[model samples]
Target: MASKVGHPLRTLVAFFIVIAALYGLMAITKNWTPRLGLDLSGGTTITLTARNTTGKGGVSATSLEQARTIIQQRVDGLGVGESQVTTSGGNQIIVSAPNVQRDELIQQVGQTAELRFRAVYQQESTTPTSQPGNSATAGTGNAQGGSTPSAKASAGTGSASAGATASSTAKGNGRPGPALPTEPPAPPSPRPTAPGKGTPENKAVEWQPSQQDITDFASFTCPRDTQYYPDVSDQPLFTCNEAGTQKYLLGPTIIEGTHVTDANASIGQSGLGWQVNLSFDSTGSKQFEDATRALSQKQSPENAFAIVLDGTAVSVASVDQAIAGGSAMISGGGINQQSAQQLANVLKYGSLPLAFEISSVDTVSATLGGEQLQAGLIAGAVGLALVILFCFAYYRGLGVVVVASLTVAFATTYAMVVLLGASVGFALSLAGIAGAIVAIGITADSFVIYFARIRDEVGEGRGIRTAVETGWRRARQTILVADAVSLLSALILFILAIGSVKGFAFTLGLTTLIDIVVVFFFTKPLVTLLSRTKFYGNGHKFSGLDATHLGVTALPGGRRRAGTATRAATQTGGEA
Candidate 1:
């Protein structure tokens, strides 16, 4: 009699109950999905081939990974969600962000993030004249054609050119016009001396555009307007006047984004608002120092430099001295708590070592993916039906054991796949499905070994009830060895291979494990219990383990009688 503790159906039931509870938990925790590949989701894919710009064998894998980190930061800073950045073929980087406009993402990914400071001349006071109605307003200098004595302009009240609507019309000459005179008859203060032309009143000051001015400048879309505002045709060597309250003239960047070692955003000491702290490598530090020192000596506006990010002015600050420590802080009035945090994240991520190139990017319509999913299910169903049919034909009543064991294996495997998909980023790809199909054969082989062992025991004249126990003893060793070899092969495949082949190895390993568990916990117990039943114990002709087929006569009390020729002949003659 089979022990209750080892009964197959009971164990199977308990296993299923545990799995069901886990499934419930999985459902509550997160939505499961086999993450789709690039082809299945519409996205932008950029392939960047590495160029040895410095001829130092281009970049090492480590450096490339760092570059990826930086690029990821820039891309994510745009507020796009769940972007993918990976390396491919050793020297190429692939970037994909689903549903984002390709042009916008491309511009963000390609920037070399070089920030520089350039000083601009500033005066003490001025009047607004950029508007036609404001033309009547007054402030400092002569309101005549060129060659009028200059008037001082304050930091905030400049840019009063009549009808000059935040256009980039500045002639790039770095010259500031005299402020409008406040009183028309006061005769311009005995001609105040020019700042750098030897005047006691001339002191270098910070010049930045007002917040309203930066906002106006940000609204501009170049190439649609007059020739005075040329669109950024180059990689934007310079960001014109401040988009912040402190307007600055920026020269071309001397250090690229790749040289930045780290960047973080934090609140200043006063706890007022957000600011970004930046650090650069030795080479970048020297360049930054040169840029700042040159800009620091100029008068207001001319004494400040602009930090241009992706062709827009995010901040502009003046340097009081040459920042020799290779670090600096950028304080922007518009940056708030949340935005500052995101900027910090961007800078932190922009220094990892991952590179990849998209080999192809094509959209898989949702309808088509649905069709594919349906087809995969149908294929799985057909394969299962064929296995069941073949088992029934050859194994007869023994096929029930095969079917039961396989069902349990399938349940466990499915639950794991779903859970893994939810937990890790695992996805059910076409290759993964193929792996599962291959595993079915492996699972079936384990069942065949088990049943054949039972037949072998019965042929050795053991009673059906005894044969069940003896068969399991022999099968255990064989099953363990077979499973071990399969697992080892899977490990080898997993470690050495990449892409879809690894999926195949993974499924194979998982099913092999399930096969062993079923054999020990479900199959052996079921057969042992069934052996105690009347039909199986008596060795009925259709039971697939009948004593006649094995040349043994089943008797009561766990005994079997061997065939005797002489007795058989005498009995046959009497019957004749």
Candidate 2:
């Protein structure tokens, strides 16, 4: 197991190996690349139209735009990046996501988007450090917290679980993380209400939490996989941080997002990087000021308020002081230009006045798909070239081995992708291509690990042949462990992940296994064969395996960090 893994002459023409290589080479180039998904290739477009219910009035411009925003959010929930949703004419909203999950996405965009103001009552988290102002107590005092039953409701023919619709387009692809809740505010009592009903004075009543709310909060878990927009402003709301780190118990609707008349993302005047500025209408301003003031006075979790949308908490921060101006700014937590814009957009689109009905769903022609396919290929090619060039520039003679091994791995992987696509309906989406690109880094890292190990052996004064064997022994275990971890992660993501990201996980897992095979069967033996050459055995200065450049100095205990390894030639090639 130790020495044999690296042997060059272990077997000549292993029948199946040769046959598979020949067949793969012959079949892989059939189309050269795997099938592209809609984002990379043109796919279908869906058009949904908003129509007001009998008493709700006609679909006004404002209502149409709001419906578009909600529809966009639903299509975006899957995070395919290839999707596009826009409102055309007065009542038409269009969505262009890949046809792979088109039906599912269509149903998602048709639901309603509600805005809510829930007070942080009691919060709990298993994370080690409790955030300032967080309470883990259940139903203690007025602390309140609960979870969204679903992120969306079925608007049309088929209704998927709210979990299915609420899948986050954000990172983590919906993985679990823990978060602590903040300060205690008395749970608002349930008060019968009318939405947007009365003057600001009438909105002053706090809605209370029921026993069901307590049970819901207690059972609430970290990293909620699904979410639903709060349809009723008077109800206790339950939600988790996107990072899954913390949970919040929030009070009633103190301030509706409609209070925010305008929002913009920009760099802070105080040089605090990016921040979001919100301007409010008079009523909105007064209400926001009161809410912020209340939050500012509370303990940590209670001190912080969540800006939630469609069953998700987009942002949460503790108030530092009373924000009385009605206008406010949000900053902190590594918010950058892009993230700030995202925050602003979410806030801007969070509350839409209308819902939409799917008008028609249609497939886009494959005519323009090549552009995305080309882009994916272009990125992969560039990344591949850079890695290969770096190996040669740094490794010198050893660059030959690195390049060869990488080529084998690449060829094998591409062949498998194509073969799988042809036989098992494994279509390659943009995310899949990204996974392959990431694999390039993993592949390069494997070479780096092995080369470093070989250099270590040479540094100890071993001949090239001996170093190769010893290095293989030490490095093989590490490579196996790393590949095992990679495969495990891929398996989990492929199993648990939804939407295109799951395909990304599949590609990742597939390529990882290929790394193991190419490294063991191709990399090890190729290096062994090359070690027999004059340039390498003699430790030519340009050879990356040269002991001196590697800083191998022979130590007093027969140890050497770097040296001329003149005795390297005396060792038999397969001595190990």
lDDT of 2 by residue, 281-366 (tens): 79876676566555555443455455554444545544444556556655544567755655555555555565556678887766
Per-candidate TM-score against the hidden true structure: 0.53, 0.43
Best by lDDT: 2
Native-referenced Cα lDDT, model 1 = 0.53
Per-candidate alpha-carbon RMSD to the true structure: 14.0, 20.4
Off by over 4 Å in 1: 1-10, 30-46, 49-379, 548-576
* Tens-digit lDDT string for candidate 1 (430-456): 556767777778778887888778777
Off by over 4 Å in 2: 1-7, 10-33, 45-358, 365-376, 553-576
Per-residue lDDT, model 2, residue 450, is 88
**Candidate 1 minimal-lDDT segment of 10 residues:** 136-145
